[model samples]
Target: MTVLQWTATLVGLSFALYIGIAIWSRARSTSEFYVAGKGVHPLANGMATAADWMSAASFISMAGIISFLGYDGSVYLMGWTGGYVLLALLLAPYLRKFGAFTVPDFVGERYYSQTARVVAVICAIFVSFTYVAGQMRGVGIVFSRFLEIDIALGVVIGMGIVFFYAVLGGMKGITYTQVAQYCVLIFAYTVPAIFLSMLITGIPIPQIGLGAAEQETGTFLLDRLNGLHEELGFAAYTDGTKSMLDVLAITAALMVGTAGLPHVIIRFYTVPRVRDARISVGWALVFIALLYTAAPAVAVFARTNLLNTVTDAPYAEMPDWFTKWEATGLISFEDHNGDGLIQYVGADAVDGTGQPVRNELTIDRDIMVLANPEIARLPNWVVGLVAAGGLAAALSTAAGLLLVLSAAISHDLLKRNWRPDISEKGELIAARVSAGVAVIVAGYLGINPPGFVAEVVAFAFGLAAASFFPVIILGIFSKRLNREGAIAGMLSGITLTAAYIVYFKFVNPAANVAENWWFGISPEGIGALGMTVNFAVAGIVSRFTPVPAGKEGRDPAEVRELVERIRVPRGSGEAHEVSG
Candidate 1:
């Protein structure tokens, strides 16, 4: 079979497996629909969580960013991976102990107000929708490139698969399917890196190979990459161009935002106990680290290979991969002097013919990971594996996001607010309907992407950090934070963050908005600012308003009880069910 045919068959088989699993494990109640019946083993939950957390951006875009940006790209690596530490230490245990099916459920019960629940639902939908848009777009890109299908048709096929599993099985189906996806994606991601690493550095372990001496240059792999980058007028591989303060702020935003994402947070609810939740995060990080650590290796190898291939090579002899990617508009080169020889030099260098050689070769960063194996002239099977991995990453996250979107509508908004008398069967139908609607919206966004995938995803994270993280954290830890404060804080935080992003992303003309960002901080990294505003607004508003009455108020006794329960170890053999 041709590469496209093979890819189609692999992807189709994977989808069929997921659909079969979903039919077999369809949710039987509201509890199962929302939290997978809370019976998932800690290790299994960890794998599922890893798949859910590492979306299309992580799988397809991150290594590519690192390849071009060098050390500056460490922010995404450090920010995304480091957040798990925060999740394991501060967030997961307490949330699992809270014993709620959804994030909105926690907000409503903790704040003792339906308004707070509604606000949480809205925030969840907003974050999930923005995230799902990128995932669907990623699916389309993979399908179009590997399966040779039209982009819109690819998106529709992906949407149909996600809708089938998510609507049929809810969180239960998604969790198991995510485990399988985690395996597919990780295998797809690491195999090429290992092959490339061994070929270039004579080391089998890509992570260590990245830091080892290069076989050709006899210098550290990173040092060689840095030298190459300097020659090309790019930033040094080990240093950054952004200010330290901006780096600090952006990293902080990503870390907190990762911890705050509603869909990620809800994964803890699937586990059986608070301690299991904590342990699960540790395992999730371990699984994620396998890919995370290998990514830099892939980046360095791909960058070195790319530079070596095109530099001084005859233009007519450029590799097939180069021409193919150029056709996709992801890779481009211009022969300014018409010498038929490609010249890649520092940004300020004069051309080989004595004319100024401006950095005019434009290559999209996303192509780095997807096109790496092909660029390195690896076997076609390796390229096929990467295709599978990219699809797995996109589909797994899309399924999880769609599940949350449907739950927000059917469970939080419809059943809780609009139709309190709805039965379990009716609620299930509502969830399916909501899933169908969400799939349509996500597919549309995928076909007509509004912005770059990474940038759009970062906006979603910022929104989630600003609106949901503060409310959930404060509700659990601070007894004095009231429902009025929670609702007001979320609305204010989301509004401010959205306005800033819109202005910076769409309105401002001078900034390139794309490159010249605010104080060197990109829109993707501005969640820290929004989060600070959220905390300040919530605190000030709460102090001025009277404490809520009854269970909503500052109940020292109940607070102590909840804390104690959360702190209890799983080995204590105490029942893990949520006891009101």
Candidate 2:
């Protein structure tokens, strides 16, 4: 069969399998809808968590950015994976012990205020929407490239699939589906990487192959990459230009944000035991690290392979990969001096006489991973496998995010706080309806994206860091923190971070520079500043305010009980009743 036909077959079969699971495990109650009846096993939950966490940014754009950013890209690697450590150590087990349906449920109940719950619902929706848009865009890209379909149509196809499982079976459907997705995505990601690593270095392991001697040149792989960069007047693959402090801020923000994201946090609440929550985090990290470690190796291989193929070559002799990417407008060439040869270099590169050199090649960083198999001249099946993997990465995360959105609207907002008399069947119906609405909204945004996939996803992390991380941590560890403090911290942090990103990214694009940035930190790194502000505001506000009291004046006692329950770890409490 043809490559496109094979891709269609695999993607179709995968979709059918997921849908069948959704039908078989359709949610019967609000409990099944919201937290999967809190019955998920640790190993299974870990696989689902891994699928939920590794979005399109992880599977597709990360390697591409690493190829161009060199050492600077370590921020993504360090920030994302490192955050799992914080989740395991600080947040996951405790949240599980709380036995809540969602993050807002914990925030609202812990603070003893419906006001706090409402605010958390807003933040959850905002962050989830921001994150899911990127996933939908990834779905569009995969479809557009592999199936020769329009991006809009691809998003619709992705939306239809997600709506089927998420709306029909809620968390129960998404959990099992994500496990299948993890298997598909991980296999797809590793297989091409293994093949390319073997081809480039004659070594089976990508991480070791990245540093070993190239089979043909007998020179270290990194050394050859460096030589190519120098010859082309580009930054060395081992070096970068971002300042250390900026890197630190970005990495720190991503770590905290990854730990605090509502979708990932909700995964902990699905497990029946607190210990499972703790161990599941470790397993999820192991799954994530598999792809995280391999990404840089793939980046190195693609960069080195492209340079070797294109440098000093005639325009007419360009490889098929070049032509294909060029068609996507992700790669372009201009022969300014009328020479048929392409010269790709940094604008700062110059001749000995101080005359600036013009780079003829323009390549988008996002195409690196997608074009890897083609660049290596691998089989069409490998390319098809990569397509399936990218879709799995995108669709799995999108489904998880939509489920959270539905939980926030149907569980947290409607049933728990606003309309407390809603019946179980009614709430279940609301979950499906909300998921459907979210899918449609996400599809629209995907067709008209706010930014590149990875960049938009970074905004989600920044929002999570600013709004959720500080308050949630303080709620668990600091017994004196009050409702007013949590509210103030969340509002202040989210406001400042959102305003900065909007101003720099949209209002005055030219002002987005190191010289003009606050503390030399770009908008991408501003979450660190926001997080610090949250910590300070909450501390100061709590010190000045009275301890929160419920209508019956028992909030302080309730808070004490909450702290004790989460800490004891022996008896994780019952999952919240899903019926309003």
Candidate 3:
């Protein structure tokens, strides 16, 4: 089948599956709606969490970034995956033991203040909306290219699918549908990567294949990539040009940011026990590692293939996929000396006069992963699989983020505050309405994206790390953190980070000096710095102020009892003990 046919068939089937799951598992109560009735199997919840966490950025843009940036891209791989370790170790289990429907609920009850809860709701909405915008745009891009639809119409179609299941099934619908999406996306990502790996290096596993000796060149695969990069005037693939301090800061920001994201943290709430939450993260990582490990290999193979095919080949002989992508204005070729052949070289290759000796081509880095299989002469079905995978990644993440967005509005903002006595049915309707509103907002943002996918996603992660992670961690672990301190800390962190990013990314066009950065860190990594400042400020302020009466301490007996129950395995047929 052609790419369009395969995309239509696979995407249609996936949508049908989601609708069926939503119908069969329609949430009947608030608990079911928010946390999937708290009966989801650990493994199943793990798969859903994997899908929830791996957004369109991971599926479509990560390898492309790695391809263009080379070793600098390792920061993303390490930062994103390492954050799961922090999640499992520091946050997930305790939140599960708290037995709340959302992260804000835990913060409110733990801190004994509605103000803290409201601050958390605001943070959740900001992080979810910023992150979901990229997913919606990714969905539109996939549809426009593979489904032969306009990008705006594609976004609307994707929005409608999200509305169908997210409104009806809530977390229950999202969880099961995410499990199916995980399967489709993972298969779609890995199969083509394996094919490319075998074709290039004669190795099946991309991770090992990347390090193995190349059949064509007697050197290691990475060494070959590095050699090719230098020949093309680009930085070596195994070494980075960024300063050590910047790399460390960026990695730190992404790690803490990953742990702080509301959508990911809320996934732990769906499991039945604390141990399930802990073990489920390991499973989620296993699934994530499948694509993460393959991504580097895809980057190496695709870059090599692109350089070989386009470097000396005439424009008329260029591949069909090249013409197709170039028509979208994503790929371009310039013949500076009227040489006819496209030159793929680094920016630094130009002479001291700031003029190129050869023609330069500029290709959008985002197209690398999507066009890799086709560029390498892989079967049409493999290209179709990638399209499906990209859709699954975007749709699953959009559903998860939309769920959090609606819950924050309905449960935290309205049910908890505006109408404390609102009926469960009323709240459910509110949640659906909130979800519909979020979809419209996300669709609009997708149609007119603010920036490139990876950069925008990084900014969102930085915000989450700086503003939310510190608040949630201190709320649970520090008894001295007062409502005033949490609010002050979040406001300060978010404000400072936003100002820094806006100034650097948009405000100052002519002044781009590294010395202007505070602490020698870029705005991309400054969120970690902001988070540290927040924690210090909160700690200092809490010391000077008196703790709210009756809210200064956790029940030690209850805490111990909860710990013991979570430590034990489930299905023992005994009533779990609780103390207060």
Candidate 4:
């Protein structure tokens, strides 16, 4: 079989395995639908969380970004991984002890108001949909490239597979399916890095290979890469272009957003106890760091290889992968000065012939990981494995996000707020049906991607940092925060962040430069500002509002009891069943 056929077979088998697992593990109760009956082992839950957290952006686009952006990409490395630290220490144990099924459930019960629940649900839905759009788009990209199909048809195939498993098994199916995906993706990601590292730096471990000496030049791998970058008119790989303040802002926003994201937080609900949640976070990070740490090394290898092989080579000497990717428009070339030799520059420049040469090569960052196997000249099976890995990353994340979308619509909106009398069975049906609808909507977004996968996902993080992170933290750590204060803070934070992003992205994109940015922070990183706004607004408004009581109104005795319950970790057992 051809390379494309091999990729199709492997990916097909992987999807079939997930669907079979879903069929065998159908959710029977509302609790099962949402949290898999709260019986998942900590280690297993950690694997599932890794799959949930590392989406298409992580698996496919992140290395490409690092390859191009150089040191600026450290923001993602620190921001995404650091959030798990906050999640473990700040939120996970407490939420697990609270025994809530969803982030909205925690908000509603903590504030003792349906209004808080409604607000939480909206934020959760918005953040999840924004994130899911990237996953769906990721699926299409993998299918288009590997399976050799139309992008729209690729989305349809992805949606059909996801809809079957997601609608059938809910969280129960998703949790188990994620475990399978984690294995496939991580293996796919690391093998290429290991092979390339050995070839370039003579080290098998990627992290160490980065700092090791280059086999050819005897200089450090990093030093060699920087030399190549400067020679080619690109930024040094270790030095960054963005201001430190913007870097700090973007990193903070991503960390908080990672902790606050509902799909990720909800993974803790599946584990059996509060202690399990804490341990699970450690394991999840361990699994995630495996990829996160290696990605930069992969970037280094890919960058070094491209510069060595492509630059200054004759057009006829270019590899087959270049031609294939060029056909997709992910890569393009034009000998602007009509020189037969390729000239790649980060800026407009003259070639060796002193001809004013416009850069011939245009490489999209999204294709970096997808094209890595080819760049390394690996075997056909390895190339096919990378395709399976990309699908795994996209599908795993999409299932987790769609679960929250459907559950919030059915449980939070229909059952809790609108029709309190609805039966649990009816609620489950609603969850499944809503999941189906979400699949189609997500597929449409995939066919017409809004932006780069990671860029769009970053917007979701900004909103989460603005809306959910502060309120949830305050609700746990502070007694003075009232329902009115939380509502106001969420509205203020989300509204301001949304306005900033919409203005730069849609309203007046030309004004997106540093001078035009408010305080020189980019829209991607503005969530840090919005998060601060949330904290400040909550603190200011909380003092004026009457202290909220317990469920009916916080009596002093009930307030103390409420604090003591979540504070003490003794009673966190199986979560009681409710509508999913």
Number of the top lDDT candidate: 4
Model 4 steric clash pairs: 549-553, 549-554, 550-553, 550-554
**Reference-based lDDT, each prediction:** 0.82, 0.87, 0.82, 0.87
TM-score of each: 0.93, 0.96, 0.93, 0.96
Model 4 spans with C-alpha error above 4 angstroms: 348-356, 549-560, 571-580
State residue 332's C-alpha deviation in candidate 3, in Å: 2.6
lDDT for each residue of candidate 1 in 537-577, tens digit (9 for 90 to 100): 99999999986665642253564455466555455243334
lDDT of 3 at 29: 88
As a whole number from 0 to 100, the lDDT of residue 136 in candidate 4 is 91
Taking the tens digit of each residue's C-alpha lDDT, what string does model 4 give over 344-398? 8867355578666567788878888988888879988889999999999999999
What digit string (tens of lDDT, one per residue) describes model 3 on residues 174-261?
Answer: 9999999999999999999889889888888888778788788778877877887776677888888877887888899889999999
For every model shown, the clashing-pair count is 0, 0, 0, 4
* Higher-ranked by lDDT: 3 or 4: 4
| Candidate 3 global Cα RMSD | 3.2
Candidate 1 Cα outliers beyond 4 Å, as residue runs: 333-335, 343-346, 352-355, 512-520, 550-580
Q: In candidate 2, what are the lDDT values of residues 173-246, reduced to their tens digit?
A: 88998999999999999999999989989999998888899999899988888887876678887987888888
